[model samples]
Target: MTTTERTAASYFLPSDEPLGLVFPDGAAADAPALPMPADDVLLRLYRGMVSGRRFDTQATALTKQGRLAVYPSARGQEACEIGAILALRPQDWLFPTYRDSMAVVARGVDPVEVLTLLRGDWHCGYDPYGANVAPQCTPLATNTLHAVGFAHAARAKGEDTVSLALLGDGATSEGDTHEALNFAAVWKAPVVFLVQNNGYAISVPLSKQTAAPSLAYKGVGYGMPSMLVDGNDAAVVHAAVEQAVARAAAGEGPTLIEAVTYRIESHTNADDATRYRERAEVEEWLERDPIARLKRYLTDHGLLTEQVQQEIDARAEDEASALRERMNVDTVLDPAELFEHVYAEPTAALRDQASELAAELEERA
Candidate 1:
C-alpha cells in the first residue's frame, strides 16, 4: 500500500490515540508530511504558542493563589487559538469565549489586561475598541449570534471585515449556535464559527454532546460550507482560517470550522475532570501536546534549535512573571468607575444609586 493509504489506515483504527495534524510520539515518523512555513512566521508562531502556554499556566496558578478569582486554562489548545488569530487582519473582529485568552493575546491584548477580567475588576479585560476583540462571552454559544449580527452590520456599512467567533464543542448543543448558523447562512454574513472541539465540555464528552460524526458537517444543514482541521497543528489551523477569512471577505457565506483538538487541563478553575475521566486519558493527551508537536516540527525543519527553544521558554517565563507582578499591583478598581460606564447618561435612579455608593465608599475611607 502507498504511504498515504497506510497512514490513513493507521488512524482509522479505534484507539485512544488523538486525531489531529501532528501525530503522537510513536506515530510522528509515519505521519504525513506538512508544508514548510517561512522561517520568520514559523518562529513567531512558536514563540506565540510558547508565550500563550506559559501565560495559561501562570494564570491558573494565580487563580489558585487567589490573585485572580477564576481562570480557564487552554493549555493544549494554544495552537488552535494563536494560529487562527494570527491569520486574521487587524480590522477583523474576534468573539472569544472564556477559554480564548490566547487568541486575545495573539490579537495584541496585553496579558495584564486579560487578568483584569479574571480579577473581577472589569467586565472585559481590554478595551474592545483598542484590540478589535469583543468582551469575552461567558455564556456558551451566545456569542455566535453576536458575531453574526456584527458581520451583518459590517456588510450593511459596506465595510470589508470578517467576524470570527470561537466556541467549544460542548457549545454546539445550544440553540443559539444553530440560530446563528441559520442567520449567517440566510444573510450571507461574513463570519466564521471556529469550534475548538477539545473532547469534553466540563465533564461531558463529544459522544454525549451530539450524534453527528463531526461538528463541521453541521454547517451543511445550514447551506454553508465547513471543514475539519487538525487544530493541534498550527500550520493546518492557520491555513484553514486563512481560507475561511478570505472567503468571508469575498462575500461568500459563513464557514464553520471544527478544529479537532484536546484540552490537556481542566475546563476551568472551578472544574475537576478527575471525577469523570481517568488519569490515563489525561496522560495520553499530554503525550500529544500541541506545543511539543510544533516545537518538534520547527526543530526538524531547522527553524528552531535547542538554544532557540531555551531562549523562547525563558522569554515566555519572564513575560509571565512580569505580568503577574503588574496584575498584583493593579488589581484594585475604582468603585465609581463601575457606575461611570453603566450608561451614556445615567438615569435618575442609577444616578442616585451611584451617589449612594460613592458616599458609602468615602465614609469607609
Candidate 2:
C-alpha cells in the first residue's frame, strides 16, 4: 500500500487506535474506571470544577452590570485549568495569565480577593507570600520567563519546587516564550509551560499565530520534551501534567504541553465573538464541552447520581452567590498603599511627589 493508504488504514484499524481516554459527544458507551481518589478529594474536585464555571459565569454577568471593570471567562477551559492545578503541591508556584482564575481558585486563592483585582481596587489582589501564588500577569508571555527564573532560584536553593506557567496559543508567538524556553533548557529549570490552545488569541485564530504543525513541538528548538493532549479531557490533562511535573521534579528540563481545546466564548467581556466567528462554529464546540464530558464520565461510572449532581450544583450556586456578595462590599483602596511598596526607601524625587500629592489633596479638601 502507498503511504497515504497505510495512514488511512491505520486510523480505521481497531488495534492501532490512539492511546488515550476518548469521550465523544460527552458520552462513553463503556466508561473506564478511574483511579480511586479519597472521597473528600473527589468531591472537592467536582465542587471546584462546578464552582469555577459558576464563578466565571457570574463574573461575566457582573461585567455586563458594570460592577466589574472587565472579565475573562474560562467557561470551556475549566478542565485544563483545574486538572493541572489539582496535580500541584502546596510549595510549587503557579504563574497564571489573566484567564487562569480557575486554576488560582483551585490553588486556594479566595474568590473575593481575586475579584479585588478585577474590580480595579488592587493591582494584585492576593498576597503571594500567604497563598504561594503570584499575581496574574496581564502582559502576555512574560510570565513564562518569570516561571523559569523562579524555578532556577528554587533549584539553586536545593528546593523541590516546580513552576507551572499557563499561557494561550497566541502567546507562543511572543519572544519572551522563546527566551524562557532557552533559559530553562540551559539551566535545567523545573518549569512546565502549559499552553492552552483555545484556537484564538483575542479573535486572531491559531492559524494566524504560527505556521508550526503543533505548539508542543516548539520545545524541540530548546531541547526540551513536549506533548500535545486533548485539553478538554480532564483525565488526559491530569495525567499529562502529572507526568510533566514528575519529569521537571526529576531535574529534567522544562516541557511544553500544548492542550488542544476550544474557548467557546469571547476573549473577554469587551469582545463580540460573533463579529469575527460564526455562531455555528461556536455551537460545534459546544457539543464537545469539557464539563459535560467529565460529568458523563462520572455518571456512567456510577460515581455521580442525580442527587449528587444536584448537590454539586447547589454548592456552586452558594459559593458564587457568596463571592458576588463579597465583591459588592466596599472596594475602595487606600491611595497611599501604592506608594508604600514602590521602593524600600522612598527616593527623594518620589518622596517629594508624594508630599506634593498629599498637600494638593489637603488643599482641595
Candidate 3:
C-alpha cells in the first residue's frame, strides 16, 4: 500500500460523539461534573459577552461608514469568543482569527488595535509580545501552526505556558489544521484548538465542508481529547476552555474544542448571507442567543438586577462610542512602514523598494 493509503485507512473506525457539557435549554449536564466558578467570575464573563456584542455592532457600523475596510462579525458567537479568552491566564497566549476581535479585546488589547489590520494600517495592529495575544489572523488555519510552535517552544524552555487558537469551522478543511493537530499531539505541545463551529464558513455550510461526525472528533484521530460545548452558553464555554487550559498546563498535551455556535451576521459587510442561508434559520439561532441566555441565567440568579443591567448597558454604549470615535480619525500612514517589519535586516530588494516609496512620499509632500 502507498503511504497515503495507509494514512487514510487509520481513521476508518467510527469515532464517538464528543463529550458535551451544556444543553440549549439552559441546563448543563456537566456543570456539576466540573468545578463551578465564583459568581463574580460568571458576572465578568457575562460582561465580556455584552462587550463583544457591542464591539461587533460598532465595528460593523464602521465598515458601513467607510472607516473599516471589512469586518467579519461574530455577533452570535460572542460567548465562544469571550468565553475561551476569559479562561486564559495573563501569561498564556491567544491566536485569533479576523472574526475573533472579541477574544482579542478580552485579552486586554485596545479595541482600535484589534481593528488595525482591517483599518489597512499594519500587518497586526498590536504588539503580540506586549499583550501575549497574536495579531488577528486573516488567513484560515495558518495560526494553528504558530500556536503549536509557540507552545512547543515554551515547553522546551520549561516555561509554564499554553496557547489557545481560535479558528472558524471552515478552517478545519485546511491542511495546516491537520498538520498542527498531529504535530501538537506527537510533541505534547500545550495548545488548545477552539473551533468556533459557527454553522457556515462564509457562504459554505458545515455539512458541505466535512463528512466527519463532528469537528471535535478530528482530534481523536490525532490522539487528543475532544470536547463539545453549547457555544451559546457562556458559562459552559468558559468551563470547558478553563478545563482544557488547565489540562494543557499540567502537560496533558493539546485539546480540540468545538463550540457549537452561529454567525448571526453575514460573513462580513461585503457578503450577502441571504443568498445561501435562510432567514428562518438565523431567527432560530437567535432564539438561543448567547447574550440573552446568559442574561437570563444571571437575572434568575439575582446577579443581574435592573440597576446592574443598566450599568452594563451604559458601559457597552460608552465602549461602542469610544471605538467609533477612535476609528473615525484618519490614520497617518508612512508608506515605507510596509517594508519595515517584514525582515530583521532589510534586503537589498526591499531597501530599494523602501527608497522608492520614500522618494514618492517626498514628491507628494
Q: Pick the candidate with the highest lDDT.
A: 3
TM-score of 2: 0.89
Question: Which regions of candidate 2 are displaced past 4 Å?
Answer: 1-20, 26-44
Q: What is the lDDT of candidate 1?
A: 0.82
TM-score of each predicted structure versus truth: 0.89, 0.89, 0.93
Q: Best to worst by TM-score, what's the order? A: 3, 2, 1
Q: In order, what is each prediction's RMSD in angstroms?
A: 5.8, 5.7, 4.5
Q: 288-365, model 1: which lDDT tens digit per residue?
A: 677788778777777788899889989998999998788667455678877766788889999898899989989999
lDDT of candidate 2 over 1-365, digit per residue (tens): 25575345332122212113547454543323223334454445566778889989988888888888988899899878987888777788999999998888878898878877788877788898676788898899999999999999999999999999999998989999999999998998999889999989998988888887778768877767677777777666666677778878998768788888889879988899988898999888888777787777677777788999999899889988998787767666666666676688999988888888888878888
Minimal lDDT window, size 10, model 3: 11-20
Error of 2 at 305 (Å): 1.3
lDDT of 3 by residue, 68-137 (tens): 8999888999889888888899899999888988888888989999898998899988899988998778
Note the residue pairs that clash in candidate 1.
none
lDDT value, residue 138 of candidate 2:
87
Residue 241, candidate 3: Cα error in Å is: 0.7
| Worst-scoring 10-residue span by lDDT in model 2 | 10-19
